[model samples]
Target: MNIKRIEDTLNEFNKIGYSRHGMNRLAFTKEEEKVKRVLIELCEKEGMEARIDHCGNVIMIKEGKNPNLAPVIIGSHLDTVYNGGQYDGSVGVGVGVEIICSINDRNIQPERRVELICFVGEEASRFGMGTIGSSAMAGKFDQEVMSRLTDQEGVSFPKAVENVELDFETIRLASREGERIHAFFEVHIEQGPVLENHQKKIGVVTAIAAPTRLKVTIVGKASHSGTTPMNYRKDALLGASEIALTVEEAAKLEAVNGTVATVGQCSVFPGAMNVVPGRAEMKIDIRGTNVESKQVVVLKLLECFKDLKNRRHLDIQYEYLVDKAPVKLDTKMINSLSTTCEELGVPHLQMVSGAGHDAMNMASICPTGLLFIPCKEGLSHHKNEFASIEDIAIGAQVLEHEILKSM
Candidate 1:
């Protein structure tokens, strides 16, 4: 494979939808459609067969000597976070495609078929769902859960499926087919400064952290801010703020090996400067590779909320959005990746992924592995997200070597 050509390909991909800050290819939107089309075009250009699956997954096939063998799947989602950097999902898909192109260029044929997938709806910005496509493919989508989900526009989950030209009932049964999948591999950015801070080139992920998302609402009586004395007020916003702070403090106390908690979104009902908030709703995300520690943190948070409710006379309610267990990568696959990195002379480390990826869903069905390259300043899901061209090329080369070995 030509390193310069691969770098050029990445550059070309980054050029699409070049906003002043970053890219805007959110899931299930027109921009996402354009991105998938571009991927299909690239696959076709490389002489690979490409098609969109029932749930809008882009599957590009490279036939091997024996078509009967289950294909080795490699890919990541093409959808980005709102105003996210280009390399987050695009790099994984781009590198997977380049692997096919390089195989064709070298006239290499393997004994097992290779399929590159660009999964849809990996980000939860749309329809309040994450890994919808992959979860369906893995046979994990529950109709009861999906039917209750809604998008930003207040569109129901079934209506969203209709808009995408997919039958809801069929999608509910989408998981039975992926059982034949061989091994799945995904390459992605670290989305943190670990590699960059350590001056390393690659991160071979050992596990993907589980996320515990809680939606907490505190209710109090609304009163005039000016007229209500501080002693007489039971401010919901104040109670919510205390819980948020306690959550942050808990995460800080548990901050060994990438444990983190984030209050990503918060809202005050009747958001007026002159009125005390009657209700405050906030989304709290707690993540950790250690399940026990995560549970401890969550328990502490709930206890704090309970204490605040009893003391402040506020109504507190909690809704869980996510509580998935951490996924450990297949040891065999991790060993293969380690051997590949050593052969390629790339300095690498076995680390746990702090952020969620599509690999988490795939791990439930088959042996899975993930490759991580450094992101500038450990920053991802932002406009200023960046990964060096050199790092990108090296990551692709490592992936190419690993694919060859795996095949």
Candidate 2:
């Protein structure tokens, strides 16, 4: 494989959403379209046929010797979170392109078709909906679900599709026949410290954590901070703080089980410093591979909410935004990837993914596997997030081997 070509592909994509903060290529934006054009152009130069599905997934196909066989699908999302790192999604897509380029260089023909897909709207940063394209293709989504997804600007998800010239009404057509897909594979950064701290080069993902997201709202009376005595105040911010700590404590209790919880977003009402906050809103994310453990944490949080409502005399209500079950990938696919690593003399660890990805949804339709390469300090979703080109090249080589084996 050509390492320079892979580096060039990633660098070209990195330039599309370049900002002082980092990459800002949110779903359905012009930056996404620009990157799609670049990918299509690159694939076309290598004699691959490319097209955009009704759901806006960019698909490029390299026909093999036997066109009748099911196609092996590879690639990842092109969109990034707001100010996210450059390597999160783009690296996988770049690897897909490089794999085909390597095959072309060797003048070899495979036994089955290979496809690269850059799924659109895989990040929840914009429409609060992640894996949109993949879910639609997996038959896991419908119009009702799409209609409920909206961005911070109050733009409906369907409207965003229309803005991008995609046919939202015909989205159901995007669903692929299960028999047509031989397998699905994705390459991503570990987005955590495990592989790096363990001195491993790759991670063979065992399972993906299921996320339960909740939006909590707390209401309290706004009052003067000074005039109101300590006992007489109804402080919403204080209530929010307590809830945050409660979440932490609950997750800590289940740490051994790998259950984790985070209160990622908090908003307080009232502009003045003197006024007791009238309301506070929080977005909580809880995830784990064990359903019982994650449910225990959720129950603990609910109990905390009830106690806080009574003792603090605050009105607290919570709504579930997402409640999904954990996904275990295909064991055959997992073993294949691990064997590939061993054959290539690569050090790898079998691990679980705490972060969600398009592979989770793709697994519903066909056999799927996820590979992880370590990032610096396991940092991701930030401007400083860095993954060495050498590591990426190693990952690409492993992925290339697996693709050929499957074909």
Query: Which candidate number maximizes lDDT?
Result: 2
Write one digit per residue (lDDT tens) for candidate 2, span 18-102.
9999998999988999999999999999999998887899999999899899999997988999999989999899999999999
Local accuracy of candidate 1 as per-residue lDDT tens digits, 207-233: 999899999989998999999998888
Count of clashes, each model: 3, 0
Please, what is the TM-score per model?
0.92, 0.94
lDDT score, candidate 1, position 333:
91
Full-model lDDT for every candidate: 0.84, 0.91
Clashing pairs in 2: none
Candidate closest to the true structure, highest TM-score: 2
Model 2 CA deviation exceeding 4 Å by range: none
Error of 1 at 185 (Å): 0.8
* lDDT comparing candidate 1 with the true structure: 0.84
